[model samples]
Structure formats: structure tokens, C-alpha cells
Target: MTIKVFDTHVRTKTSRYLHFDVLIEGNDTEKAQAHARQYLLEKGLTDEDIAQSECRFCHVEPGNPVVAQAISQQGYYILELQGCQED
Candidate 1:
């Protein structure tokens, strides 16, 4: 199966916008955003509403075995591209 890839940008009150490619099993923007929020929480990033902190669908591609595991568990996977690992 294919996945919907959303180009995501998240910024904190005191930090710059961090980039992440959020991959989900479906194309629902709300669902994708929700999942992205959950990811931030898991990473201890933020708990405030992320309504303005999400998604622009960039592409659809074939299945990726690497991300399949995460998608199966949380309905999505995050590809960290820049400034996502620092404190």
C-alpha cells in the first residue's frame, strides 16, 4: 500500500520551526495532524494545540518497509530532516 507524506513544520514559543516529513497510512489531514501532535508529546516537544503546526501534503509513494512498523503502531511515521534532534 501507499502512504501520504505531509511536509510538516513545528515551532515552539522560543524555538525555530523544525522540519519533519510525517508519513501516514491515509490522507486525512486532521488525523495526520493528531498523530503528529502525539509524536511531539512522545518526544517531549509540546502539548499545546498544534492546529497551526501541521501539514501540507507533498506526495504519495509506494510502501516503505522501514516506516511500515511505526505506521502500524501509531498510524504514522516521522522523518526528521532538520533541527529536530537538538534541545
Candidate 2:
């Protein structure tokens, strides 16, 4: 099955933004948003931030279809996830 990387961002209470990506089922925005919420929760992000957070696919890249990486504004070394494709 073909897949695409859904790029998005989530903001914390400190007003810090986390740029990340999700491997969605397709180019559906709803699915991407849902995946973003679930992904943040799984990463231990607070519910408040998760609730207040909004996700939007910035763009996609060509490849085996995986979440690219997470970049922090503070320049923190963020771990990259080989995101799994949604069923």
C-alpha cells in the first residue's frame, strides 16, 4: 500500500512548538489529525496540550513513507520515529 508522511506541529503549555510527522493511511486530513493526537498522547505529552493542539499536514516527501523527524525550537536533539502506517 502506498503511504505519505503527514507533517504537523503541536504546541505545549510553554508555547513551545514541536514539529513532527505521521504516516497516515492516505492524504485524508481527518485521519492525519487523529493520528497526530494519538501520537502525541503516546509520546507522554499532556492531555491539555493534546486537547488544545491542532494538526495540519504541511507537506510530504517521497520515500518508503515514514514520519520524517521532530524538530524543537530550542534546538534539542529529538529522536526520530519510523512511523508505522495506519491500517
Cα distance off (Å), candidate 2, residue 35: 0.8
lDDT string, candidate 2, 44-77, tens digits: 6767754245556555444332222222222111
Q: Which TM-score value belongs to model 2?
A: 0.55
lDDT of 2: 0.52
Model 1 lDDT per residue over 1-87, tens place: 698998988877665667898898888988878877777787777655343475788899986788888788767889998777867
The residue pairs that clash in candidate 2, if any, are: none
Q: Give per-model CA RMSD.
A: 2.3, 10.2
Off by over 4 Å in 2: 50-54, 60-87
Model 2 weakest 10-residue run by lDDT: 70-79
Cα displacement (angstroms), candidate 1, residue 16, comes to 2.9
Q: Please report the candidate that would top TM-score against the real structure.
A: 1
Please state the error at residue 76 of candidate 2 in Å: 25
Which stretches in model 1 have alpha-carbon errors above 4 Å?
47-52
